[model samples]
Target: MDDGNVSLDRMRTFVRVAQRGSLSAAARELGIGQSTVTRHINELEEALGVSLLGRTTRRVTLTEEGSQYHANCLQILRLVEQATEEARDARRVPVGVVRVSCTSALGVMHLARIIFAFQDEHPDIRIDLNLTDERIDLAREGVDVALRLGPVMDDAMKLVAIGASGRRLAGSRDYLASRGRPARPAELTNHNSIVMSNVAGSEHLLLSAPDGTRLMVPVSGTLRVDHGLAARAALAAGRGIAPAHLWLIQDLLDAGKLETVLDEYDLDAVPVSLLVVPERAGIARVRLLVDFLVDEIRKLPGITPHRSASG
Candidate 1:
Protein backbone atom coordinates (compact mmCIF):
# COMPACT_ATOMS: atom_id res chain seq x y z
CA MET A 1 0.00 0.00 0.00
CA ASP A 2 1.26 3.49 -0.80
CA ASP A 3 1.65 5.65 2.31
CA GLY A 4 0.48 8.51 0.13
CA ASN A 5 -2.83 6.70 -0.36
CA VAL A 6 -3.96 7.54 3.22
CA SER A 7 -5.22 11.09 3.63
CA LEU A 8 -5.46 13.05 6.87
CA ASP A 9 -9.19 13.51 6.28
CA ARG A 10 -9.65 9.74 6.19
CA MET A 11 -7.79 9.35 9.46
CA ARG A 12 -9.90 12.13 11.00
CA THR A 13 -13.05 10.40 9.81
CA PHE A 14 -11.94 7.15 11.44
CA VAL A 15 -11.26 8.91 14.74
CA ARG A 16 -14.51 10.82 14.73
CA VAL A 17 -16.49 7.74 13.83
CA ALA A 18 -14.82 5.79 16.65
CA GLN A 19 -15.61 8.50 19.18
CA ARG A 20 -19.24 8.89 18.12
CA GLY A 21 -19.88 5.11 17.70
CA SER A 22 -21.97 5.40 14.51
CA LEU A 23 -21.78 6.87 11.04
CA SER A 24 -24.79 9.11 11.62
CA ALA A 25 -23.36 10.40 14.89
CA ALA A 26 -19.99 11.10 13.27
CA ALA A 27 -21.74 12.91 10.44
CA ARG A 28 -23.70 14.99 12.94
CA GLU A 29 -20.62 15.92 14.98
CA LEU A 30 -18.38 16.48 11.95
CA GLY A 31 -21.20 18.34 10.14
CA ILE A 32 -20.74 16.07 7.10
CA GLY A 33 -23.22 13.90 5.29
CA GLN A 34 -23.42 10.23 6.25
CA SER A 35 -22.52 9.16 2.72
CA THR A 36 -19.35 11.28 2.81
CA VAL A 37 -18.34 9.89 6.21
CA THR A 38 -18.99 6.32 5.02
CA ARG A 39 -16.96 6.95 1.89
CA HIS A 40 -14.04 8.27 3.96
CA ILE A 41 -14.13 5.26 6.29
CA ASN A 42 -14.30 2.80 3.42
CA GLU A 43 -11.42 4.53 1.67
CA LEU A 44 -9.30 4.50 4.83
CA GLU A 45 -9.95 0.78 5.50
CA GLU A 46 -9.09 -0.09 1.92
CA ALA A 47 -5.88 1.92 2.10
CA LEU A 48 -4.84 0.33 5.36
CA GLY A 49 -5.82 -3.19 4.14
CA VAL A 50 -7.90 -3.84 7.26
CA SER A 51 -11.48 -3.58 8.42
CA LEU A 52 -11.72 -0.55 10.68
CA LEU A 53 -15.26 -0.89 11.95
CA GLY A 54 -17.72 -3.71 12.62
CA ARG A 55 -21.09 -2.25 11.84
CA THR A 56 -24.39 -3.58 13.22
CA THR A 57 -27.93 -2.40 12.79
CA ARG A 58 -27.99 -0.63 16.14
CA ARG A 59 -24.39 0.63 16.40
CA VAL A 60 -20.76 0.50 15.24
CA THR A 61 -17.66 -0.63 17.12
CA LEU A 62 -13.98 -0.73 16.27
CA THR A 63 -12.24 -3.98 15.42
CA GLU A 64 -9.23 -5.00 17.55
CA GLU A 65 -6.85 -3.34 15.12
CA GLY A 66 -9.24 -0.42 14.76
CA SER A 67 -9.20 0.15 18.51
CA GLN A 68 -5.42 0.37 18.63
CA TYR A 69 -5.39 2.57 15.58
CA HIS A 70 -8.05 4.82 16.99
CA ALA A 71 -6.07 5.44 20.17
CA ASN A 72 -2.85 6.11 18.28
CA CYS A 73 -4.66 8.34 15.85
CA LEU A 74 -6.14 10.42 18.64
CA GLN A 75 -2.73 11.04 20.22
CA ILE A 76 -1.09 11.84 16.90
CA LEU A 77 -3.92 14.04 15.62
CA ARG A 78 -4.16 16.05 18.80
CA LEU A 79 -0.42 16.64 18.90
CA VAL A 80 -0.40 17.77 15.29
CA GLU A 81 -3.23 20.22 15.87
CA GLN A 82 -1.69 21.40 19.13
CA ALA A 83 1.63 22.15 17.43
CA THR A 84 -0.05 24.06 14.63
CA GLU A 85 -2.14 26.08 17.06
CA GLU A 86 0.87 26.79 19.25
CA ALA A 87 2.80 28.10 16.26
CA ARG A 88 -0.13 30.32 15.26
CA ASP A 89 -0.55 31.66 18.80
CA ALA A 90 3.20 31.96 19.55
CA ARG A 91 3.19 35.71 19.08
CA ARG A 92 -0.17 36.19 20.77
CA VAL A 93 -1.25 35.33 24.30
CA PRO A 94 -3.16 32.14 25.03
CA VAL A 95 -6.58 32.73 23.47
CA GLY A 96 -9.24 30.40 22.06
CA VAL A 97 -12.18 28.18 23.05
CA VAL A 98 -11.73 26.44 26.41
CA ARG A 99 -14.46 23.97 27.35
CA VAL A 100 -14.71 23.29 31.07
CA SER A 101 -16.95 20.98 33.10
CA CYS A 102 -17.67 20.85 36.82
CA THR A 103 -20.04 19.34 39.32
CA SER A 104 -23.30 21.16 39.95
CA ALA A 105 -22.52 22.70 43.34
CA LEU A 106 -19.06 24.00 42.54
CA GLY A 107 -20.13 25.03 39.07
CA VAL A 108 -22.72 27.34 40.54
CA MET A 109 -20.98 28.19 43.80
CA HIS A 110 -17.38 28.58 42.69
CA LEU A 111 -16.51 27.81 39.03
CA ALA A 112 -18.84 30.36 37.45
CA ARG A 113 -17.01 33.26 39.11
CA ILE A 114 -13.56 32.03 38.07
CA ILE A 115 -14.66 31.52 34.46
CA PHE A 116 -16.04 35.08 34.40
CA ALA A 117 -12.71 36.39 35.63
CA PHE A 118 -10.79 34.28 33.10
CA GLN A 119 -12.96 35.66 30.32
CA ASP A 120 -12.36 39.21 31.51
CA GLU A 121 -8.62 38.69 31.28
CA HIS A 122 -8.59 36.67 28.07
CA PRO A 123 -11.21 38.44 26.04
CA ASP A 124 -10.50 36.35 22.95
CA ILE A 125 -10.93 33.02 24.76
CA ARG A 126 -14.43 31.64 24.38
CA ILE A 127 -15.34 29.66 27.49
CA ASP A 128 -17.81 26.77 27.59
CA LEU A 129 -18.48 25.49 31.09
CA ASN A 130 -20.62 22.36 31.44
CA LEU A 131 -21.94 21.76 34.95
CA THR A 132 -22.97 18.19 35.75
CA ASP A 133 -22.52 15.45 38.32
CA GLU A 134 -22.16 12.86 35.58
CA ARG A 135 -18.61 11.73 34.84
CA ILE A 136 -17.30 13.29 31.60
CA ASP A 137 -15.15 11.82 28.83
CA LEU A 138 -12.74 14.68 28.18
CA ALA A 139 -11.91 13.47 24.68
CA ARG A 140 -15.34 12.25 23.66
CA GLU A 141 -17.18 15.12 25.37
CA GLY A 142 -14.84 17.76 23.95
CA VAL A 143 -13.90 19.13 27.38
CA ASP A 144 -10.68 21.11 27.73
CA VAL A 145 -10.70 21.35 31.54
CA ALA A 146 -12.90 20.18 34.38
CA LEU A 147 -13.32 21.64 37.87
CA ARG A 148 -14.05 18.38 39.64
CA LEU A 149 -14.42 17.08 43.16
CA GLY A 150 -13.22 13.75 44.62
CA PRO A 151 -10.78 11.45 42.83
CA VAL A 152 -9.99 11.03 39.13
CA MET A 153 -8.95 7.49 38.15
CA ASP A 154 -6.95 8.23 34.99
CA ASP A 155 -3.18 8.69 35.45
CA ALA A 156 -2.39 10.20 32.04
CA MET A 157 -4.08 13.59 32.49
CA LYS A 158 -3.02 16.18 35.07
CA LEU A 159 -4.90 17.04 38.25
CA VAL A 160 -4.00 20.27 39.93
CA ALA A 161 -4.69 20.14 43.68
CA ILE A 162 -7.46 22.65 44.16
CA GLY A 163 -8.55 22.59 47.77
CA ALA A 164 -10.37 20.38 50.27
CA SER A 165 -14.16 20.19 50.50
CA GLY A 166 -15.13 17.71 53.19
CA ARG A 167 -18.79 16.98 53.58
CA ARG A 168 -20.67 17.87 56.78
CA LEU A 169 -24.07 17.13 58.19
CA ALA A 170 -25.86 20.46 58.07
CA GLY A 171 -29.31 21.99 58.05
CA SER A 172 -30.89 25.41 57.67
CA ARG A 173 -30.71 27.81 60.61
CA ASP A 174 -34.41 27.52 61.06
CA TYR A 175 -34.19 23.72 60.92
CA LEU A 176 -31.33 23.47 63.37
CA ALA A 177 -32.66 26.04 65.78
CA SER A 178 -36.15 24.71 65.61
CA ARG A 179 -35.18 21.03 65.63
CA GLY A 180 -32.09 21.44 67.82
CA ARG A 181 -28.55 20.61 66.58
CA PRO A 182 -27.60 16.95 66.22
CA ALA A 183 -25.21 16.23 69.09
CA ARG A 184 -23.90 12.96 67.55
CA PRO A 185 -23.77 11.01 64.31
CA ALA A 186 -26.41 8.61 65.57
CA GLU A 187 -28.64 11.57 66.25
CA LEU A 188 -29.00 12.02 62.48
CA THR A 189 -31.24 8.98 62.53
CA ASN A 190 -33.62 10.80 64.83
CA HIS A 191 -33.93 13.85 62.58
CA ASN A 192 -36.06 14.37 59.50
CA SER A 193 -33.27 13.50 57.04
CA ILE A 194 -34.01 14.83 53.60
CA VAL A 195 -32.48 12.42 51.09
CA MET A 196 -31.36 13.89 47.73
CA SER A 197 -32.62 10.98 45.66
CA ASN A 198 -33.17 11.51 41.95
CA VAL A 199 -36.68 11.42 40.56
CA ALA A 200 -36.33 7.65 40.38
CA GLY A 201 -35.57 7.70 44.13
CA SER A 202 -33.27 6.12 46.75
CA GLU A 203 -32.06 7.24 50.20
CA HIS A 204 -28.40 7.52 51.14
CA LEU A 205 -26.05 9.64 53.23
CA LEU A 206 -22.36 9.69 54.12
CA LEU A 207 -22.23 11.44 57.47
CA SER A 208 -19.27 12.05 59.75
CA ALA A 209 -18.27 13.35 63.14
CA PRO A 210 -15.57 15.95 63.93
CA ASP A 211 -13.30 13.28 65.40
CA GLY A 212 -12.88 11.68 61.90
CA THR A 213 -15.43 8.90 62.47
CA ARG A 214 -17.78 8.16 59.58
CA LEU A 215 -21.17 6.61 59.02
CA MET A 216 -23.23 5.75 55.98
CA VAL A 217 -26.76 6.49 57.05
CA PRO A 218 -29.90 5.38 55.23
CA VAL A 219 -32.28 8.31 55.15
CA SER A 220 -35.96 8.91 54.36
CA GLY A 221 -37.75 12.22 54.02
CA THR A 222 -40.97 13.94 53.19
CA LEU A 223 -39.27 14.81 49.90
CA ARG A 224 -36.78 12.93 47.72
CA VAL A 225 -35.00 15.40 45.45
CA ASP A 226 -32.36 14.98 42.77
CA HIS A 227 -31.04 18.35 41.67
CA GLY A 228 -28.43 19.87 43.98
CA LEU A 229 -30.10 23.26 43.94
CA ALA A 230 -33.41 21.71 44.87
CA ALA A 231 -31.71 19.63 47.54
CA ARG A 232 -30.04 22.75 48.90
CA ALA A 233 -33.37 24.47 48.96
CA ALA A 234 -34.89 21.46 50.67
CA LEU A 235 -32.07 21.50 53.20
CA ALA A 236 -32.42 25.24 53.73
CA ALA A 237 -36.16 25.04 54.02
CA GLY A 238 -35.68 22.67 56.95
CA ARG A 239 -37.00 19.84 54.85
CA GLY A 240 -34.45 17.58 56.55
CA ILE A 241 -30.85 17.08 57.53
CA ALA A 242 -28.49 15.98 54.72
CA PRO A 243 -24.80 15.87 53.89
CA ALA A 244 -23.54 18.74 51.76
CA HIS A 245 -20.23 19.80 50.25
CA LEU A 246 -18.49 22.46 52.32
CA TRP A 247 -18.37 24.93 49.45
CA LEU A 248 -22.05 24.70 48.63
CA ILE A 249 -23.18 25.36 52.18
CA GLN A 250 -20.52 27.95 53.03
CA ASP A 251 -22.57 31.08 52.52
CA LEU A 252 -25.62 29.69 54.19
CA LEU A 253 -23.58 28.39 57.09
CA ASP A 254 -21.86 31.76 57.47
CA ALA A 255 -25.16 33.57 57.22
CA GLY A 256 -26.18 31.32 60.13
CA LYS A 257 -28.86 29.84 57.92
CA LEU A 258 -27.22 26.39 58.10
CA GLU A 259 -25.24 24.81 60.97
CA THR A 260 -22.80 21.89 60.90
CA VAL A 261 -23.53 18.84 62.97
CA LEU A 262 -21.31 16.11 64.55
CA ASP A 263 -18.24 18.30 64.98
CA GLU A 264 -16.30 15.38 66.55
CA TYR A 265 -15.78 12.98 63.64
CA ASP A 266 -13.35 13.71 60.81
CA LEU A 267 -15.40 13.59 57.66
CA ASP A 268 -13.59 13.11 54.37
CA ALA A 269 -14.10 16.28 52.43
CA VAL A 270 -14.15 15.37 48.75
CA PRO A 271 -10.73 16.26 47.35
CA VAL A 272 -11.14 19.14 44.97
CA SER A 273 -9.34 18.66 41.66
CA LEU A 274 -8.90 20.53 38.37
CA LEU A 275 -9.05 17.71 35.75
CA VAL A 276 -7.01 18.91 32.74
CA VAL A 277 -6.98 16.90 29.56
CA PRO A 278 -3.74 15.68 27.98
CA GLU A 279 -4.33 17.87 24.94
CA ARG A 280 -4.18 21.00 27.12
CA ALA A 281 -1.57 19.71 29.56
CA GLY A 282 1.19 22.10 28.41
CA ILE A 283 -0.83 24.75 26.56
CA ALA A 284 -0.30 28.19 28.05
CA ARG A 285 -4.01 29.06 27.81
CA VAL A 286 -5.04 25.93 29.71
CA ARG A 287 -2.22 26.36 32.20
CA LEU A 288 -3.33 29.94 32.80
CA LEU A 289 -6.97 28.95 33.28
CA VAL A 290 -6.14 26.04 35.61
CA ASP A 291 -3.94 28.25 37.76
CA PHE A 292 -6.54 30.98 37.85
CA LEU A 293 -9.23 28.46 38.89
CA VAL A 294 -7.04 27.01 41.64
CA ASP A 295 -6.39 30.50 42.96
CA GLU A 296 -10.03 31.52 42.86
CA ILE A 297 -11.47 28.29 44.34
CA ARG A 298 -9.15 28.59 47.35
CA LYS A 299 -10.54 32.04 48.00
CA LEU A 300 -14.00 30.53 48.35
CA PRO A 301 -14.89 31.14 51.97
CA GLY A 302 -15.15 28.07 54.27
CA ILE A 303 -14.34 25.49 51.57
CA THR A 304 -11.30 23.25 52.04
CA PRO A 305 -9.93 21.69 48.81
CA HIS A 306 -6.76 19.62 48.56
CA ARG A 307 -4.98 17.00 46.44
CA SER A 308 -6.98 13.77 46.44
CA ALA A 309 -5.32 10.98 48.37
CA SER A 310 -4.25 8.08 46.17
CA GLY A 311 -6.31 5.01 46.93
Candidate 2:
Protein backbone atom coordinates (compact mmCIF):
# COMPACT_ATOMS: atom_id res chain seq x y z
CA MET A 1 0.00 0.00 0.00
CA ASP A 2 1.28 3.49 -0.89
CA ASP A 3 1.48 6.35 1.60
CA GLY A 4 -0.85 8.40 -0.64
CA ASN A 5 -3.38 5.56 -0.54
CA VAL A 6 -3.66 5.51 3.30
CA SER A 7 -7.27 6.04 4.45
CA LEU A 8 -8.51 7.85 7.56
CA ASP A 9 -11.21 5.18 8.04
CA ARG A 10 -8.55 2.44 8.18
CA MET A 11 -6.48 4.41 10.69
CA ARG A 12 -9.55 5.00 12.86
CA THR A 13 -10.48 1.31 12.79
CA PHE A 14 -6.95 0.29 13.76
CA VAL A 15 -7.04 2.67 16.76
CA ARG A 16 -10.36 1.23 17.87
CA VAL A 17 -9.01 -2.35 17.61
CA ALA A 18 -5.92 -1.43 19.57
CA GLN A 19 -8.02 0.15 22.33
CA ARG A 20 -10.56 -2.70 22.50
CA GLY A 21 -7.85 -5.42 22.47
CA SER A 22 -9.94 -7.58 20.10
CA LEU A 23 -10.83 -7.09 16.42
CA SER A 24 -14.24 -8.70 16.94
CA ALA A 25 -15.02 -6.35 19.86
CA ALA A 26 -13.96 -3.25 17.80
CA ALA A 27 -16.13 -4.58 14.94
CA ARG A 28 -19.10 -4.83 17.30
CA GLU A 29 -18.51 -1.26 18.57
CA LEU A 30 -18.19 0.10 15.00
CA GLY A 31 -21.23 -1.92 13.83
CA ILE A 32 -19.11 -3.55 11.09
CA GLY A 33 -18.35 -7.16 10.26
CA GLN A 34 -15.15 -8.79 11.73
CA SER A 35 -13.70 -9.38 8.25
CA THR A 36 -14.01 -5.63 7.34
CA VAL A 37 -12.20 -4.62 10.55
CA THR A 38 -9.41 -7.10 9.84
CA ARG A 39 -9.09 -5.82 6.26
CA HIS A 40 -8.84 -2.15 7.52
CA ILE A 41 -6.07 -2.98 10.00
CA ASN A 42 -4.25 -4.99 7.30
CA GLU A 43 -4.46 -2.10 4.84
CA LEU A 44 -3.17 0.45 7.42
CA GLU A 45 -0.23 -1.85 8.36
CA GLU A 46 0.60 -2.39 4.69
CA ALA A 47 0.57 1.41 4.03
CA LEU A 48 2.91 2.13 6.96
CA GLY A 49 5.13 -0.93 6.21
CA VAL A 50 4.92 -2.03 9.89
CA SER A 51 3.10 -4.52 12.02
CA LEU A 52 0.79 -2.35 14.17
CA LEU A 53 -0.60 -5.16 16.36
CA GLY A 54 0.63 -8.39 17.95
CA ARG A 55 -2.42 -10.61 17.42
CA THR A 56 -3.03 -13.93 19.29
CA THR A 57 -6.03 -16.25 19.28
CA ARG A 58 -7.61 -14.50 22.31
CA ARG A 59 -6.51 -10.79 22.20
CA VAL A 60 -4.63 -8.06 20.31
CA THR A 61 -1.88 -5.75 21.64
CA LEU A 62 -0.07 -2.79 20.07
CA THR A 63 3.48 -3.27 18.76
CA GLU A 64 6.31 -0.89 19.80
CA GLU A 65 5.85 1.39 16.72
CA GLY A 66 2.06 1.12 16.97
CA SER A 67 1.99 2.59 20.47
CA GLN A 68 3.55 5.90 19.32
CA TYR A 69 1.31 6.01 16.20
CA HIS A 70 -1.81 5.38 18.31
CA ALA A 71 -1.00 8.39 20.55
CA ASN A 72 -0.51 10.65 17.50
CA CYS A 73 -3.79 9.41 16.03
CA LEU A 74 -5.65 10.22 19.22
CA GLN A 75 -4.36 13.81 19.20
CA ILE A 76 -5.26 14.28 15.55
CA LEU A 77 -8.80 12.94 16.08
CA ARG A 78 -9.39 15.16 19.10
CA LEU A 79 -8.21 18.26 17.20
CA VAL A 80 -10.54 17.45 14.33
CA GLU A 81 -13.48 17.18 16.72
CA GLN A 82 -12.63 20.55 18.34
CA ALA A 83 -12.42 22.29 14.98
CA THR A 84 -15.79 20.88 14.00
CA GLU A 85 -17.38 22.19 17.22
CA GLU A 86 -15.93 25.68 16.76
CA ALA A 87 -17.31 25.90 13.24
CA ARG A 88 -20.77 24.89 14.42
CA ASP A 89 -20.70 27.35 17.34
CA ALA A 90 -19.74 30.28 15.10
CA ARG A 91 -22.93 29.98 13.06
CA ARG A 92 -25.47 28.11 15.18
CA VAL A 93 -24.91 29.53 18.68
CA PRO A 94 -24.15 32.86 20.34
CA VAL A 95 -21.17 31.95 22.53
CA GLY A 96 -18.52 34.56 23.27
CA VAL A 97 -17.79 37.78 25.17
CA VAL A 98 -19.05 41.03 23.60
CA ARG A 99 -17.56 44.22 24.98
CA VAL A 100 -19.69 47.36 24.62
CA SER A 101 -19.02 51.06 25.26
CA CYS A 102 -21.74 53.63 26.00
CA THR A 103 -22.25 57.06 27.53
CA SER A 104 -22.58 57.07 31.32
CA ALA A 105 -26.02 58.64 31.44
CA LEU A 106 -27.50 56.50 28.65
CA GLY A 107 -26.03 53.34 30.12
CA VAL A 108 -27.50 54.01 33.54
CA MET A 109 -30.90 55.32 32.46
CA HIS A 110 -31.65 53.07 29.49
CA LEU A 111 -28.92 50.94 27.93
CA ALA A 112 -28.39 48.81 31.04
CA ARG A 113 -32.00 47.65 31.10
CA ILE A 114 -31.90 46.77 27.41
CA ILE A 115 -28.70 44.77 27.89
CA PHE A 116 -30.16 42.89 30.84
CA ALA A 117 -33.16 41.88 28.73
CA PHE A 118 -30.90 40.86 25.86
CA GLN A 119 -28.80 38.66 28.17
CA ASP A 120 -31.97 37.02 29.44
CA GLU A 121 -32.88 36.05 25.88
CA HIS A 122 -29.36 34.95 24.98
CA PRO A 123 -27.86 33.24 28.01
CA ASP A 124 -24.74 32.07 26.19
CA ILE A 125 -23.50 35.54 25.20
CA ARG A 126 -21.64 37.54 27.88
CA ILE A 127 -21.68 41.35 27.85
CA ASP A 128 -19.06 43.65 29.32
CA LEU A 129 -20.48 47.17 29.37
CA ASN A 130 -18.08 50.08 29.89
CA LEU A 131 -19.80 53.39 30.61
CA THR A 132 -17.93 56.66 30.36
CA ASP A 133 -18.40 60.26 29.34
CA GLU A 134 -15.16 60.50 27.39
CA ARG A 135 -14.76 58.89 23.96
CA ILE A 136 -12.26 56.03 23.54
CA ASP A 137 -10.77 54.18 20.58
CA LEU A 138 -12.88 51.08 20.05
CA ALA A 139 -10.18 49.03 18.29
CA ARG A 140 -7.48 49.79 20.83
CA GLU A 141 -9.84 48.98 23.69
CA GLY A 142 -11.14 45.81 21.99
CA VAL A 143 -14.74 46.97 22.20
CA ASP A 144 -17.20 45.05 20.05
CA VAL A 145 -19.94 47.70 19.87
CA ALA A 146 -20.77 51.27 20.94
CA LEU A 147 -24.00 53.22 21.34
CA ARG A 148 -23.66 56.93 20.80
CA LEU A 149 -25.73 60.07 20.35
CA GLY A 150 -25.54 62.00 17.06
CA PRO A 151 -24.03 60.83 13.75
CA VAL A 152 -21.16 58.39 13.26
CA MET A 153 -17.96 60.45 13.14
CA ASP A 154 -15.50 57.63 12.36
CA ASP A 155 -15.65 56.82 8.68
CA ALA A 156 -13.99 53.45 9.24
CA MET A 157 -16.85 52.17 11.42
CA LYS A 158 -20.12 50.70 10.13
CA LEU A 159 -22.92 53.04 11.31
CA VAL A 160 -26.53 52.09 11.79
CA ALA A 161 -28.85 54.93 12.83
CA ILE A 162 -30.94 53.33 15.53
CA GLY A 163 -33.39 56.16 16.33
CA ALA A 164 -33.84 59.87 17.05
CA SER A 165 -34.40 61.63 20.39
CA GLY A 166 -35.20 65.29 20.94
CA ARG A 167 -34.07 67.59 23.72
CA ARG A 168 -36.76 69.62 25.52
CA LEU A 169 -36.73 72.72 27.73
CA ALA A 170 -37.89 71.22 31.01
CA GLY A 171 -38.34 72.40 34.62
CA SER A 172 -39.62 70.71 37.74
CA ARG A 173 -43.11 71.73 38.87
CA ASP A 174 -41.83 73.35 42.07
CA TYR A 175 -39.18 75.32 40.19
CA LEU A 176 -41.71 76.45 37.59
CA ALA A 177 -44.10 77.57 40.28
CA SER A 178 -41.36 79.46 42.11
CA ARG A 179 -39.79 81.10 39.02
CA GLY A 180 -42.90 81.37 36.84
CA ARG A 181 -43.25 79.26 33.61
CA PRO A 182 -41.84 80.59 30.36
CA ALA A 183 -44.74 81.29 28.01
CA ARG A 184 -42.43 81.44 24.99
CA PRO A 185 -38.85 80.68 23.96
CA ALA A 186 -37.70 84.23 24.60
CA GLU A 187 -38.75 84.07 28.26
CA LEU A 188 -36.31 81.14 28.93
CA THR A 189 -33.44 83.60 29.30
CA ASN A 190 -35.23 85.15 32.30
CA HIS A 191 -35.39 81.81 34.17
CA ASN A 192 -32.25 80.24 35.65
CA SER A 193 -31.06 77.18 33.63
CA ILE A 194 -29.20 74.11 34.97
CA VAL A 195 -26.60 73.73 32.23
CA MET A 196 -24.69 70.57 31.29
CA SER A 197 -21.10 71.80 31.20
CA ASN A 198 -19.79 68.93 29.07
CA VAL A 199 -22.35 69.26 26.28
CA ALA A 200 -21.51 71.45 23.30
CA GLY A 201 -23.73 74.54 22.92
CA SER A 202 -25.39 73.87 26.27
CA GLU A 203 -25.33 77.61 27.00
CA HIS A 204 -27.68 78.24 24.07
CA LEU A 205 -31.15 76.83 23.70
CA LEU A 206 -32.16 76.42 20.07
CA LEU A 207 -35.87 76.31 19.41
CA SER A 208 -37.81 75.80 16.17
CA ALA A 209 -41.22 77.29 15.46
CA PRO A 210 -44.14 75.58 13.71
CA ASP A 211 -43.47 77.46 10.43
CA GLY A 212 -39.79 76.24 10.48
CA THR A 213 -38.36 79.41 11.99
CA ARG A 214 -35.38 78.84 14.31
CA LEU A 215 -34.13 80.89 17.25
CA MET A 216 -30.93 80.58 19.30
CA VAL A 217 -31.44 81.98 22.78
CA PRO A 218 -28.56 82.63 25.21
CA VAL A 219 -28.98 80.64 28.45
CA SER A 220 -27.49 81.19 31.95
CA GLY A 221 -27.74 79.28 35.21
CA THR A 222 -26.26 79.13 38.72
CA LEU A 223 -25.56 75.36 38.47
CA ARG A 224 -23.31 73.66 35.90
CA VAL A 225 -22.47 69.94 35.84
CA ASP A 226 -20.23 67.66 33.72
CA HIS A 227 -22.67 64.76 33.28
CA GLY A 228 -26.29 64.67 32.12
CA LEU A 229 -27.33 62.56 35.09
CA ALA A 230 -25.96 65.18 37.45
CA ALA A 231 -27.79 67.92 35.59
CA ARG A 232 -30.95 65.81 35.81
CA ALA A 233 -30.47 65.52 39.55
CA ALA A 234 -30.09 69.28 39.85
CA LEU A 235 -33.28 69.78 37.81
CA ALA A 236 -35.15 67.22 39.95
CA ALA A 237 -34.04 69.14 43.05
CA GLY A 238 -35.62 72.28 41.51
CA ARG A 239 -32.24 73.90 40.85
CA GLY A 240 -33.48 75.50 37.58
CA ILE A 241 -34.90 74.80 34.10
CA ALA A 242 -32.63 73.13 31.52
CA PRO A 243 -32.65 71.42 28.14
CA ALA A 244 -33.08 67.68 28.70
CA HIS A 245 -33.52 64.66 26.47
CA LEU A 246 -37.20 63.67 26.51
CA TRP A 247 -36.38 59.96 26.70
CA LEU A 248 -34.45 60.55 29.92
CA ILE A 249 -37.19 62.62 31.54
CA GLN A 250 -40.36 60.94 30.30
CA ASP A 251 -41.08 59.32 33.64
CA LEU A 252 -40.63 62.65 35.39
CA LEU A 253 -43.03 64.26 32.95
CA ASP A 254 -45.59 61.48 33.53
CA ALA A 255 -45.32 61.79 37.29
CA GLY A 256 -45.70 65.59 37.04
CA LYS A 257 -42.28 66.09 38.58
CA LEU A 258 -41.05 67.82 35.40
CA GLU A 259 -42.90 69.63 32.62
CA THR A 260 -41.92 70.88 29.18
CA VAL A 261 -42.07 74.58 28.38
CA LEU A 262 -42.71 76.34 25.01
CA ASP A 263 -44.20 73.15 23.51
CA GLU A 264 -45.00 75.02 20.29
CA TYR A 265 -41.30 75.38 19.45
CA ASP A 266 -39.97 71.85 18.88
CA LEU A 267 -36.33 70.98 19.25
CA ASP A 268 -34.60 69.13 16.42
CA ALA A 269 -34.35 65.36 16.72
CA VAL A 270 -30.81 64.10 17.26
CA PRO A 271 -29.85 60.75 15.78
CA VAL A 272 -28.72 57.91 18.03
CA SER A 273 -26.59 55.31 16.28
CA LEU A 274 -24.76 52.03 16.81
CA LEU A 275 -21.12 51.84 15.79
CA VAL A 276 -19.00 48.74 15.15
CA VAL A 277 -15.84 47.91 13.26
CA PRO A 278 -16.86 47.18 9.68
CA GLU A 279 -15.17 43.78 9.70
CA ARG A 280 -17.00 42.69 12.87
CA ALA A 281 -20.43 43.42 11.35
CA GLY A 282 -20.38 39.99 9.74
CA ILE A 283 -20.16 38.16 13.10
CA ALA A 284 -23.39 36.42 14.12
CA ARG A 285 -23.57 37.70 17.72
CA VAL A 286 -22.67 41.25 16.74
CA ARG A 287 -25.31 41.37 14.03
CA LEU A 288 -27.94 39.90 16.33
CA LEU A 289 -27.17 42.36 19.13
CA VAL A 290 -27.36 45.35 16.81
CA ASP A 291 -30.74 44.25 15.55
CA PHE A 292 -31.98 43.68 19.07
CA LEU A 293 -30.90 47.13 20.25
CA VAL A 294 -32.45 48.89 17.27
CA ASP A 295 -35.78 47.18 17.86
CA GLU A 296 -35.87 47.99 21.56
CA ILE A 297 -34.72 51.60 21.20
CA ARG A 298 -37.48 52.41 18.73
CA LYS A 299 -40.01 51.48 21.38
CA LEU A 300 -38.64 54.02 23.86
CA PRO A 301 -40.68 57.12 24.68
CA GLY A 302 -39.92 60.24 22.59
CA ILE A 303 -37.76 58.08 20.29
CA THR A 304 -38.64 57.47 16.65
CA PRO A 305 -36.97 54.94 14.38
CA HIS A 306 -34.63 56.41 11.84
CA ARG A 307 -35.80 55.92 8.25
CA SER A 308 -32.71 53.91 7.36
CA ALA A 309 -33.03 51.85 10.57
CA SER A 310 -36.67 50.93 9.94
CA GLY A 311 -37.11 47.51 8.31
Which structure among the candidates has the greatest TM-score?
1
lDDT of every model, 2 decimals: 0.76, 0.83
Q: Report the Cα lDDT for residue 229, model 1.
A: 83
Candidate 1 deviant stretches above 4 angstroms:
1-5, 56-58, 137-142, 173-180, 196-227, 254-257, 263-266, 305-311
Overall local distance difference test of candidate 2: 0.83
Per model, state how many residue pairs clash: 18, 0
Which tens-of-lDDT digit does each residue in 103-200 have in candidate 2? 99888999999999999999888898999878876754556789988766898788888778877888999999998999888888898998888888
| Predicted model with the maximum lDDT | 2
Instruction: List candidate 2 segments past 4 Å from native.
Output: 1-91
Looking at model 2, the pairs that clash are none
> Candidate 2: deviation at residue 294, Å?
0.7
**Lowest lDDT block of 10, candidate 2:** 77-86
The residue-level lDDT of candidate 2 at 22 comes to 96
**Per-residue lDDT of model 1, residues 1-311, tens digit only:** 65665877878888888877889999997899999999998878888899989999989999999988887787777788789668857876777777798888678866788788888988887887889888877775567888776677868677777777767778887887788987766667778987766523236555454554567766666776667787788888888887777767777887888887766655566667777887777777777787788777877765564546321
